[model samples]
Target: GTYRAFVDQLPRLDALGVTAIELLPVHQTDPQEGSYWGYMPLCFGAVHAQYAAGDDPAAELAALVAAAHELDIEVWLDVVVNHTTEVDAAGPTYHLRGLDDAMYRRRGDGSYIETTGCGNDVDADHPAAQDLVVWSLDRLADLGVDGFRFDLAAVLSRSPSMMSRLEAWARTRDVRTIAEAWDAAGGYQVGRTWPGTGWMQWNDRFRNDVRSFLRADDGSAALMEQRVQGSPDLFDAPGDSINYLSCHDGFTLYDVFAYDAKHNGANGHGNRDGADDNRSWNCGWEGDDGAPDTVLALRRRQLRNAWCLLAMSHGVPMVAAGDEHGRTQGGNNNAYNQDNATSWIDYARRDEFADLEHFVTGLLALRARHAVLTQPEWWGDALTFLDRRGVDGSTAGPSIGWSVGDLCVLANAWWHPTEFALPPGSWTMAVDTNQADLLDPPTPVDASAYVVGPRSAVILTR
Candidate 1:
């Protein structure tokens, strides 16, 4: 979509109550490369020309940023300084590679290092390389971008001085920074190892554990409890985690319950490109095609359940585009090549999954209203984990419940209903995923225990 088209969606996004918008690598990609996802940056200073409806891509991008700021939404751009479009020895020689071979990491034999799995990794230790990255950051900040998400940022950790330079730049700009926190070469620096102070990280552990727990995987309940509390064991506090279930890389929220395997033949990799361990459950059905209405309804409920978990979690929740409205990639998790309808968002789905859209909107609004959900610190003494019977100190079952201060979330992943004992107080039910209008007017629960529907979540506030 063009920058103008993206700006048009800001009103709807603002109404959905998102505080920030994270755009995938907008840096211009080589036209000859034909990469759908612009991760392979041709030049960091240039905006992808195809993303602009007008001739001046930089102006269009600036306008988009200004419009988002009008609504008080920060624009976080994803950047790829880890590697470039000029991949390996056989690849095209773009700016850096053509100018100096040492710009890329090389072995003693002069073979390129493949830390990012992109054939070549940028040598962050090189003086010229560091200059290039810092200069790009300055230019991008001048474009009015508020923050950045560094793709495969663990590569930067290898050069501590370069990482320091980046941290200094971010401090000077007073902007937020996030890291993918790992590289293809098994460099996983998730928590404090991520080096950047005040920088957040994409917590894949939350994604995996939550998916496994919802799908009733064995021994997933305890992990779910930890992730729901913002992955305290991994990070120092809640704000350190950019908790997400699905992103641009893998399955969308809809696909998480609609497919069991990666259908990436469309990616032209013989169905072997994307991750096989998707941790997805198809709710007793494979593809959506010819699926019975019963399965479809169950999938919708599961989708809502996922959203409920994300909204109630104690950290920043990342919602992938079109996920609130049941967007699917036809099971093609890696649809980078298919830039056609498989990857394009169909707004018509918004009406089809209107209930889900409403649910997401209300759920996010609910999170926005509750400071407990966004608090940067751990729940500490204010948190309590309960079992299916609502007994404290036991959450190793298909059902789980947790409360922080006045807010409580009870998730039942079982096929049967679950009885949850509410904490002592007059409680109001703010969300019940079983209902068609998930955020319908709150109802007063005059009981000591509430029965959550099969595979649904109930949020209560006292």
Candidate 2:
């Protein structure tokens, strides 16, 4: 049932320029409250029977994979190997609990060590658990799936040796593995967690810093610089980060700028459900409003700013679904349970949505065109940061206190306009996130300076 639906939807998504469909946990989950994000997994070996067609679950999955492959789209599975749905005695029974309780989960003093905050954490240190995890991955790999987005991956590496072993096992496979490496403490020490070269982590630092800059926080400029260049403070190597402005969790990008405080009353939490430190700004208005042209202009510019930052950042860019159309959850940042219009992508708002889609497509294409932007190698010929002199220099060579190479990015986080003189050469104006008229046409004179609108970003290339 679910697989067939996905198979039918694959072509449409491809047409919309989606090359990957990251499926929420597909493993067997509790049947009653089963479809809630798939984080509450019950069986690691078996596919969720409800998603399968009739009794032939394997066949259904195989067919789905074949269809996606035919469209040249890759299927990425969301795996939750860190924990299981076996919460209490009332929870559903699965392979791990049935086979051997001790082999499946971690226990201390005869009590389950609940590191995942989801009742129980898998005993990754256990040899049996390791075997089960590795076997499950190998099974998916054999089925022609592309990669895995490991949910709560930090919990899987509670024991350092276990993380190392898992990384070693992952490297053997011909697929990509992305880790949700965030722990509860907000410490993004990727250097300590990542096992080796093959893993890429969700860069929370980038998300926070970029959001802070958009809100015009003090010292945000410095933080934004760190994020755009890939936080060397958090990550040890380059290209090991997945830069995202918004994701399935927390406030949508539109909501981030549309609301200063979360309105999560819909989640039955009386607005106390989600995070309070959202780092968002409402741009002088709270929630939704059919305001004047100025308000709409500001909102549009903010959206472009977030998109450009995500695309230009030094990492794998993850664009949350519906972000292109400025989707909002009506200020419900934590709409994990409210799976109504709050979570689904709104196909309405066609005009605004189309513009956003076009902007993102062009942004992605621009990034792809520049090898320095996406290359695994650090500080390649494609990226650069220019100082005032370099920005105003007559020649293209390196100027005082500037990182020069290919593309030059200018960001003006201040409320007032800022101007930068262009290097004396034919430099194409790549993007103006503020949607300002100054960015129109003729690629301003080589020696002439370009004005950046307040709270905006601009990309230039020679």
Candidate 3:
């Protein structure tokens, strides 16, 4: 019934101009663990029975997929293959653990080898685990789902050859493959970590780099440059890096600026459940309830800045489901346990921050309309950054150059205003985060240089 509720909103998602819908794990969960988020899967062959509007879970899920396809909206499942709800030896033996403990990872002493930080990790290195995962993919593919984003995908990397074979299976069937690409323990494959054949990974590099750069951390300019250029060091290909600023695991884009520290006490884990280094700046206050208007406006602009940077980056950009409309998780970074309004997108905020929605719309429209932004590879020397000074150009400057069709985006993270040198041309301002809406019109800046506002971003189209 809950998933059928999502089917009713396919048009809403399509209207946002996003291409794919990433659903959290939908597989059945054992009741003993109370896995609200569905990451703790009980069986790979079935959809969770509770989510079905009808008696047949498979049929209900298939109808949802069919509805999404009618709207040309690709549905992607965030499936977990790393571990199960049958957590540890003491946990439960309802499914996988009961079927065969050897099917799951274990040390020689018969203790669980916990790579997932979820106590029990599925033994993906074995052929049986590979067959189960492949079978699940085929089942969903036959049901008409478009793609899958693997949770704790780095576990697949443990058996890289098996990972490649599974990826190959998806490709043969024409299903798009993506991965979380890391485990909680030690797998940080932000870019090109696994062979990743026929696959893309969630770009943690893009997320952290953009946050730190926007907050004006030390040496952030170069970091910003690398990300804007698509992080070629870690990724050998373009779309291989899923450029993003926020996701389900951390603060929403709005909350990233609305809260300086995580307030995850409601998670009942002593406020230590979520990330400690959020790289967030709350403008002036710790929470959103009572911030000054100036602070609020700055926060809004910063949200737009993050959005614009994501749009401008070379990789395939991924925005959290509600980030475009300024969704706040009430400072609950680890809201995996939150199933109420705290986790749901507040429709009221969508209109309250309608300016943000408009800006994001224009940004996505702009990205879709530009070839440089949508290129399958970095523009290389074609795109160049110009270090800026004050309006009079007195401060130190970095090399400023650009190709004829490239988009030159300037970001002023300094506390004060910074000036930039734009090559004299028929350049139109494609984006300015400082504007009321991101794109009011194509303002012609026929000057050789211009001053950028403090803590703001500008995009120039030549």
Q: How well does each candidate superpose onto the true structure, as a TM-score?
A: 0.97, 0.87, 0.95
TM-score of candidate 3 on Cα atoms, chains taken together: 0.95
Q: lDDT at 71 for candidate 3? A: 84
TM-score of 1: 0.97
Error of 2 at 204 (Å): 0.7
Clash pairs for candidate 2: none
Candidate 2: lDDT of 408?
66
Stretches off by above 4 angstroms in model 3 are 392-406
lDDT of 3 at 371: 85
| Highest lDDT scorer | 1
The lDDT values for all models are 0.87, 0.71, 0.80
Off by over 4 Å in 1: 390-396
Of the pair 1 and 2, which is ahead by TM-score? Answer: 1
How far in Å is the alpha carbon of 62 misplaced in model 2? Answer: 3.7
What lDDT is obtained when candidate 2 is compared to the true structure? 0.71
* Best-to-worst ranking by lDDT: 1, 3, 2
Could you tell me the lDDT of residue 233 within candidate 2?
Answer: 68
